[model samples]
Target: MWVRYLGFVILFGLPGALHAQPCGAPGLDGGYFVPLQETYSHEIEIIYACDSGRKPAVEGWWATSTCQNGVWSPEPQCIGEEDCLPPEIPNAKFNKKQNSWYNEGNTIRVTCDNGYELKNRDATAVCLNGTWTSVPVCEISNNTCGEPPQIPHAVIIGQKYQASFAADSKVRYKCEDGYSVEGAESKKSIFCISGSWSELPKCSRGTRQNTGHGSSVEVTTSAGSGTQTVGGGSGSSAGGTAGGHPTSTESGTQPGGGGRGSGDVVHGGPTITGSSTTSVSNDRNSKPAFIPVNECGVSPVIPNGVVVQTERMYLKYECNSYYTRVGPDTVVCTNDGRWSELPSCKEAFCVLDLAQYSGIGIRQTGKEYIKEGETKNVYCSYYDYVIFTCTQGRVTYTRCCEAYYHNYGGC
Candidate 1:
């Protein structure tokens, strides 16, 4: 029987043990005996099955025992799936005073006022978790002014206005004499940021004095004065009339005086007596004396002619002669008449005979030789006829008479 029980325990596990409970059997000694009764707790331990063996028991595990009372029991099993928690949501807040935001993964944008700008972040921001990785802050941005107005007689202080300037911008003021600053005397420099000037310059009446000479003229203005002196022989003068009359002297004896006179008389006043003082005067009071100034002293004008002498011929005047100056030392004439140093005649020469024919008396063919005022012609020794002319003043000829008579000359 014991062997059968042991086999059952191995085949059917602990479940079979419940069926085998309450069995009475006798020992070899013949004494009465009962089957040993045992008790078990209802608790069990479970481990995770992984590639690296197993993890510590997290679920489906009992703390103390696996079985309880007379029943068979098992520990609860853990649901074996991926059990990771989702990421935590971030908390975000806006800082109204700072005009920015705090946190990561959260966004905040910035804008500026009309005349101002954002000194810091100009875009959105993000918040991540409990802790903000990036915090954005907005600051004041712009601080500038417009161009200052232009001032006459005053110079600009410096360059253009800077929104962030400390000092060093300055302007200076000045004016002519008798002029002063109306408001502030020492306040030549003005602060640019305030946009105010130092003061307006002012002008007052001034006095002036003429230094020298005849009519004294004065010009006065609110700012200053000017003076001018007129008349006198050797000084500066003023224009226009003085009192009611003209400023120039009325006496003709003065250097630039006007008077009525004729034939070189200094009139309207006294005259300086020189070696020759013929006090000439003019009857017409309206006209002044006329004194001509002499430019040419003692020069003579020569006539034009051609004068001929025994040894020289002076071809003086070819009518309407013209001379052109070329340079300092050269003069050119239109005609061919020119003289080097002296006027002299040139010797005239001419050939005595022109024809080669040999004859004594006039060989008259059908031609005849007339006297001075007549036309003439002669026959050549070899040809027909030719004409000859005599000298203007006189004419004479001598030849071999026999040769001439034999050679066609009728003796």
Candidate 2:
């Protein structure tokens, strides 16, 4: 009976009948295992024990299967948790020394240097995960200066001038001779970059030299004034004296060589000059002293027999009236010595001659009806067959045209 019991025990203890020990099974002594589940698709944490007597943790997911005690179990997969975290993007710039992180959204900003404007958008950026999208580079904007003011005939020199500029740009200025600049000279040389001109410079009145001897002199030669002194003397000699000094000398007479007689007399002329005279015997006749010509005041006098008159709206001159038309009208000189031109006369109108019936007479030369100085032409016909037209006032030829007296009874 004891032998029979031993055999039954041996049969139950066979390799297939007893529980099989796990080869690399993870458990409480080495590491903790997270059971596989559909919801847990990512890496699961596994706490494992190392030979150093410290418990270490390994992360992995279920990879293979195993059988133990007639039951099948899922294998725990081991991998690094580093991969679970998102990858670190390189070359990402962070401001304020802030560290980049995953799962947390952050942003970054960019700027440019002075004198260099940003070419890209000035204000936005983003942080995705631990990385940032490549942002466009900030470039320098174009530099420019605006055009200068419109000073006609002015020239600008440098290429630095362009349309986009601020105020206070400098520009130069210059003007032609007869004209002068008004504003600040230095400022004129430079203009505001914005194109405005500097203050204008002051201009002075022009001057001219007069026609006589004094150093500085001015004369007003208008129509009324007969003579203006403009520096030189007129009758007596007034200038630098014999002592090399300037002086004005009036009329005076010197002693005569023979006997002291009455002194020679000198009269004033238009121009001034020095005169030396000596007394002579009253018995001897003497020529008059030298007198200067009238240089300042002299106007030409109109001569007689010169025809100075208006004809056909023009000035006409005739020495004799024999070859020209003669009339009672004439030009004359006024008391002021100024001559007047002949006035235009009135025209003559045709009138029927009751006695001669066929011929027409001047009803009244419209001369009587015309205004004092008005002019007109006159037309007449003989026997209602021939036509003649004459200009009133001065002498003029009679003109004959085909239509001279058409409707006024045949000429």
Candidate 3:
């Protein structure tokens, strides 16, 4: 039928022509369309579908979605990590209007008006990260995700003995004795989904290269969400969230990504913890010049840095909020400086989660990766708020408000 009226003119934008519709799936309301057979009715095929208990995040670069005419090519958006705000459920009546936020299967169709019927309610009341599940009583009885998320040094190849954990379960992630996941499909493993469990890949550890006078050391240990489990291995998520800065187990090779290091290697690498010395004198008499500290320590405050110090040993850097400076903004007075190689502020990738597109009235923010010409900003208040940049890493989209440019297909 003319490609279902060209996907209803690219989803109500009218005008005509323009077709692709990743199943017409929007967010917070559910997403996951599969109805088009009566002469292919009018067409609509969205996908993101979640809410039986929340837990359906799709954005590992877009999991899956394709349609090319009326738009809707690569729209995947149904993320979740436990975020149940707004009464979520006390009385209940969802498919609820969005202010921007909803995850996990995304459902809530309970009716307890007239005489109130639905004890162990199970028709739909998902949304798990923040909370909301089995919280449906309606004056009566009632009823009803994963279990393999413990990777700190990594280790779980064939360990079994579960008291509970069922639903396509899976587990085999490794990296314990010293941490490692340099490829090999990143060691791959972690499934249980729906009920929750997937999310754990990134062990990497072994990057201590100061080669100047040899003397650098750094160590970090974290485990505090009841003692860690569920990977929370922390940071690198990208797109679906977790864009840099949870760091700790870093040594360098790229492979994944994890920061922290560069305060002069943490303030102690001049024959091992001796630089921080201040005796500045460029040439007045030719003396007082001893400021080593660079194995990544001694001045590390990169949340959105600026750091600039010089007397002749030379040093200057910058990495404001939108961060993006990695190695050598300026550091001279040369003496074979490798000070263990320091320079990184990074952080800036896939942003925008108005609770997960609350109601879809229109919302977007950028970063989903950028480099080409640099530029990065993509916000919206209505619809079609595209404006992405970056060439080599690939991402090109544009609509109106182009503050910097969003990323990947949009508008």
| Per-model RMSD to reference | 56.4, 44.9, 28.9
Summed backbone clashes in each candidate are: 15, 37, 66
lDDT of 1 at 148: 41
Worst 10 residues of 2 by lDDT: 260-269
Better of 1 and 3 by lDDT: 3
Using lDDT, rank the candidates from best to worst. 3, 2, 1
Which stretches in model 1 have alpha-carbon errors above 4 Å?
1-145, 161-187, 193-411
Give one digit per residue, the lDDT tens place, for model 3 in 1-411. Answer: 999999876778854434433233333344344332222212344334554544344323223444445344455445454555434344345465453555443546666532233563344555554556665555411100334656667767785755335432456777654445532222556543223443455565543333233232222212111110011022211122221312223222212113233211221111101122112112222321223435324554555667664322335567775566665454432234334234677664434333343343335432244543344444456434444555444455455543222221123
Worst 10 residues of 1 by lDDT: 325-334
* Candidate 2 ranges with C-alpha deviation above 4 Å: 1-145, 158-161, 176-179, 183-187, 190-411
Task: Report how far off residue 275 is in candidate 3 (Å).
Answer: 41
- Candidate-wise lDDT, in order: 0.28, 0.31, 0.40
For residue 99, give model 2's deviation from the true position in Å. 28
Error of 2 at 39 (Å): 61
| Position 118, candidate 2: lDDT | 37
Over 4 Å off, model 3: 1-308, 317-382, 387-394, 398-411
